[model samples]
Each structure stands twice: as structure tokens, then as C-alpha cells.
Target: MIAPELLSGLPSTEELPCSDDTPVDNEDQNSLPNLLLFMLASLWAERMDWYFGVDMAIYHTTGEDPRIPVVPDAFLSLGVERRKGGRSRRSYATWEENGVVPTLVLEMVSHKPGGEYGAKQEIYRQLGVLYYVIYNPEFWQRDRHQPFEVYRLVDGQYQQVFSTAEADHPYWFPEVGLGLGFRQQRLGGIEQEILVWYDAQGNPYPTPDEVQLQLRQRQQELDAERQRAESERQRAESERQRAESERQRAESERQRAEQLAQYLRSLGFDPDQLPEQ
Candidate 1:
């Protein structure tokens, strides 16, 4: 907490810039976070307890200066208004938020290393962030780390997590009730490798387009089943009609035989004995 004297001296979030203005080195840095945001928006559209930001400044008094911020490529905070006070936030100020820090922070490694493995990790640790994710897709070889890494704050230190290759690689967060992983998915009408959310069972939550496609496919299947059922009903009805027709024909033949027998008996000629035809 900032001392009373220092609290008044701190600059408001509105006074700070939302980003550092350093140009993003690659498109993935921007697009990947957006993909996550898009998926979250679709998945949690009705919920107002979470906020996700991309390239946004997060100001806190834990640092030497409250006005200065550590801008993450993307960050998520639970138990915060989806909009700050029903308005978009210019920046996230911990003091204004009842000291609610970000639940997770992420950095996408660009052409140049951004100290994700060293300095940023420490900074996030000091900031009390629960989870830190470094996505170094292209520069993993140079950094001597995997393309994706998730670190959890354990005992005031960041601990790297490892998982076997047999299962789908996703770091599940029981606190958030979701998982983070990579998948080949299309976004903004372009197919590419992207980050996606998963469930506790390692099943990915489908994107909006995927959900729509599934709904359409399910409707088609239902229509086909209905058609098949109708065809079977028609076949059964036809069989019933044919059986009825045969029954009527037999009845008519029996009645005709009886009538001929009666006429033959009136003539004193036994029809049963005289019949060679």
C-alpha cells in the first residue's frame, strides 16, 4: 500500500499513456492476444468479473514510481469489472482497484528478446502476479527454452512447470477454471497457429465460428434423421396397404367360391367333384 503522503503524489491512470509506443516486432504478438480475447469474449460474454487487456499499461505503487508501468503484451485480472466503473479503462491502477493485481501476465517474444526470461520474470514476481507466460515461438532456440512456458508464483518465487509430451500440452489453472494451450485455428478469416483456451479435461473451447459450424452440422444431421424416419413410416404404411389388399382379394375369392357352390348345389351338381378347371 502506498503511504498517505505518497498516495496523493501518485498520478492518476488517466494521466498515463496506455502503451509504451514501442513498435511490435511481429504480427503474432498482437494477433495471439487478440485471438485469446476474442475467444474469451465469446465464452464469457455475459460474465462481468474478468478483464483482458492487450498492450495496456498497468500502473501500481509497488514500483519506485506509481506513474510508471510495466506494459505486458496481454494480461488478465479476475474479480474486476469487465469495464472499470462501466467505462473503458485508460490504464489499470492497483490503488483504484482495491489492490487487485493481475491474475496472469504474458509476453510474446519478438525478433529481439524482451528480457522475458530474466528481468520481466523478476518484475512479475515482485508485482505478485500469480502466473507469467512467455511465448517465444521463433526465438525459443536462441533463448534455450521451449516455444511456450508458464510459470506459477510459488512461495514468492516463479516456478517453471513441465509436462510430458504424451498428453495435450496445456497449463491448467484451477483458480481460473480454464487452461491455456496452442492450436491450429483460423482467426479473422486466416488460418494459423494460435493460442486457445481449454477445459479441465484438456478439451478446447470452440471459437465462435466453430460453434456456429457445429450447430449447422447438428441441424443437418437432425434433418437427415427426420427424413429417414419419414421414409420408414411410408414404407410401413405401404406394406400395411399391400397386406390389406391381399386380404380383401382372398375374402372376395372365398365369397365367390361359396356363391358358385351354392349355385351348383341348386342344380344338383356338386361343384367340388366336377371341377377340373
Candidate 2:
């Protein structure tokens, strides 16, 4: 932890720029990170001790200047406020956050490289980050690196822990209690690749769209069940009415026979002695 006297002189997050004003080369640079952030929001809805930032500047004193920030495509800091002081964070300052560095940082390679393997890696290493992820899907051949790579800080050095070749996807991070992986999915009527979170068993968590589809399916099933029950009740009621009508017809015939017998007795005729017809 930085000394109190040293932290007192540092600039507040409000005074720092939110980012370095560098425009992304492609839409994936922004969309992918935000997708991860959204997934985390759903997965950890009940938890209030984590914060995920997308393309946000992170200020720390480990570098040559506290003012200079290293902006990752995305970063996750555990044991920190989801919202700082009941308000959205303009920027993340390590000093303001009680020296809580980000546990994980993600960098997505775009058409142009932005030092994901060299300078930024060193920066995260100096900041004591636990995990660093580099996602280079399109330009991996040019960069001579895997499309997806996960590095774990071991003995103050970042070591390659997992890659796509290992086929152990949705690699679980025991420290963070989450897994990271990618899959081919069609978004907005176009098929593309997307990174997704996974459970300890490597089951990918459903997106919000998937959740809505599941809810709709469940509702439709319930509606069908209700219709079947109503149909059964109507059929039972029809059978009961038919049975009552038959009972009434039999009773009418018995009453008519008794009346006829009474009339024959008045006329001095024995109805029982009459020949069968």
C-alpha cells in the first residue's frame, strides 16, 4: 500500500482523463470488451465487490508518472466497489482505490498493434496484475502469436498459462471463479466470433438474448398446457350433460307407464293381463 502522505498528493480520478483519446482501429476493439463487461454484469448480478471497465484509463504510481494511464481494452478489479461511492467511476486510480490493482486485464488486437505483448505487458506486470489476456484473432499470423492467449503472473513474471492449441477452452481461473473462451455466434444476422464467460464446468453462460429466448419458450409451453387442460374440462362437462339427459328420458318413460296403468284400472281393464305388444 502506498503511504498515506504519498497518496494525499496524488490527483483524484475526477482530475484525470478517462482515456488516452486513441480511437479504435476497428469495431471489435470496443464491441468485444463491452460484450465481456455485459456478461460479467449478468453473471455477477448479486455480487457487489467487482468492477469491469472497458477502454478506461487506469492510473497507478508504479510507472514513471502517475498521470500517465495504461488503458486496456478491458480490466476487472475484484474486492473493489462496483460503483465508487454510489457513483459511476470516471477513471480508476490505484491510490484512490486503496492500492487495489486490477486482477485481470484484457487487450484485443486490432488492425494496428498497440503494444499488447511488450510495453503494456510490462506495465501490468509492474502493477501486480494476476492475469493478462491478449486476443489477436485476425492478425495472429502477422504477429506470430496465437489467436487467444492467457498469461498468469508467476514469481513476478508473466508466464503463458493457456492457449488455443491446448484445446482446454473456457479456461477456468480459480482465483476469479470464472472461465474465458470464445465461440462462433451470429450477431445482428451476421455470423462472427464472440468471447464468452464460462462456469467452472466449462458451460458457457447464456447471453441476455439467449435468456429472453428461453423465457419465451417457457411461456409458450405453459400456454399450451393450459389449453389442453381447458379442452379436457370441456369434454368432461359435455359427457356429464349427455348422461343427465339420458337419465331424464328414462324417468319420463317410467312416469308415463304409471299414468297409463292408473287409467286402465279406472276403466275396469287390467293392463297387466293384456297381451304383450
Candidate 3:
């Protein structure tokens, strides 16, 4: 906890640089984090006590200088306003936010290693971040690390908390009430691997596009059902009209026969006797 007296002297978030302005070596550095941010937004649309930042600066008093921010690929902070002061935050300053540090930090390893395993891990450990995730999809062999790894702060140190087993693909974080995992998906007509959020039961939450597709499929099914019912109703109506027409024809024939019999009786000839001819 930063002392109130010292906190007052620290620079505000507005005055701090949002990030180091380092260009990402690969597209995943920017795209992947934004994907996670978008997923979180959809998952926690109603919640107002969380914030997810991508390539954002996090200023803290734990470091030598509060001005030197640790810009993670992505970070999630709980117990903080979704929007600070009814507006978007310029940067996440621990002192301004009641000294609440990020709960989790994500670092995506690119072509060039960005110290994800050494320096940055130590930084997150010092900041008391509970979870640290390192995703090294393409260059894991070079770094001698797994493609995906999750570390939990245990006794002031980060310990590996995930395995490479298929059954344990999605590592659940009970503290955050969400799980992190990877799956292959097609995005923008390109098939690639992507991170996904999971429930405790290991059910992956559908993307916005998937949800919309499901809705459209359901509507089409309902329309088909309605059409089938209308066709059955029309067939029944046609059958009833045909039966009515047959009944009218029989009645007319009976009336005509009775009229012919009456005329024969009026002519003084027995119709029953003439019917044999």
C-alpha cells in the first residue's frame, strides 16, 4: 500500500504516457490482446467492476520510478471501475486506483523475445500480480518453454500452474471465476489459433459471431416449422372444400330424381314401374 502522503506526490494517469510506443514485431501482439479484451467485454457486459487493457502502461510505486510504466501485452484489474470517472482511463496508475494492482498480466512472445520469462516475470512478481500468462506459440522451441504457460504467485514467487495435457487444456482460475484456453478458429477467413475463455465446467463461451449465427439458425428453424403448419392447414381446408362440393352434387342429383318422379306421378304413370327401362 502506498502511503497517502507519498501517493499525493505521484503523477496522475493523464500526465503519464500510455505506453513505451514500441512497435509490435508481429500482428498477434496487438490482435490477440484486443481479441481477449473484446471477449471479456462480451462476457462481462453487465459487470462494472473490471478493466482490461491492451498494450497499456501500468504505473506503480513498487518500481524505482513511478514514471517508468510496465506495458504488458494485456492486463486485467479487478475491483476497479470499468470506466474511471465515467470515462476511459489514459493509463492504469496504482496509486490513483487505491493501490489495486493488476490481478493478471498476459505477455505474448513474438519473433523476438521480449523478456517474457525473465525480466517481465520478475516485474509482475514484484507488483504482486496473482496470475502471469506467457503465450509463445511460434517460438516456444527457441525459448525451450511450452507454447502456453500460466504462473501463479505462490509465497511471493510465480509457480507454473498449468500442464500440456489435452484434458487440462483450459486452466481454470477460480479467483477470477473464468478459465483460459486455446482453440483453433477461423477469423477473417483465415484459420488460426486463438485464446478463449471457459467456464468451470470447461464449456467455451461462444464468440459474438457464433452467438449471432445461432440466433439466425433458430429463427430459420422456427420459420420452417411455421411454413409446415400452414401447409397442413391449407391441405385440410382444401379437403373440407372438396367434401362440401361432393355433398352439394349428391343433393342436386337426389332433388332432380324426386322432381322426375313427381312429374311421372302427375302424368298418371307409375315411376317405379318405368324405372326398370
Please give the CA lDDT of all the candidate structures: 0.85, 0.90, 0.89
| CA error at residue 99 for candidate 1, angstroms | 0.7
Q: Can you write out model 3's per-residue Cα lDDT over 1-277, one digit (the tens) per residue?
A: 7887897689998899989998899998898788888888999999999999999999987789989999999999999999999999989999988889999899999888889999999999999999999888888889998888999999999999984524237888888999988878766567888887889999888766677778999999999999999999999999999999999999999999999999999999998888564
Model 2: CA > 4 A from native: 165-168, 250-274
Write model 2 residue lDDT over 27-108, tens digit each, in one string: 9989888888888898899999999999999999999999999999999999999999999999999998889999999999
Model 1, range 107-166, lDDT digits (tens) per residue? 998898888888878888999999998877677888788878889999999998742222
In terms of TM-score, the best-performing candidate is 2
Selected candidate, larger TM-score, 1 vs 2: 2
With candidate 1 superimposed using the best TM-score fit, by how many Å does residue 1's alpha carbon deviate from the native? 4.8
TM-score of each: 0.76, 0.91, 0.87
The pairs that clash in candidate 3 are none
Compared with the true structure, model 2 gives a TM-score of 0.91
Error of 2 at 178 (Å): 0.9
Evaluated at residue 262, the lDDT of candidate 3 is 98
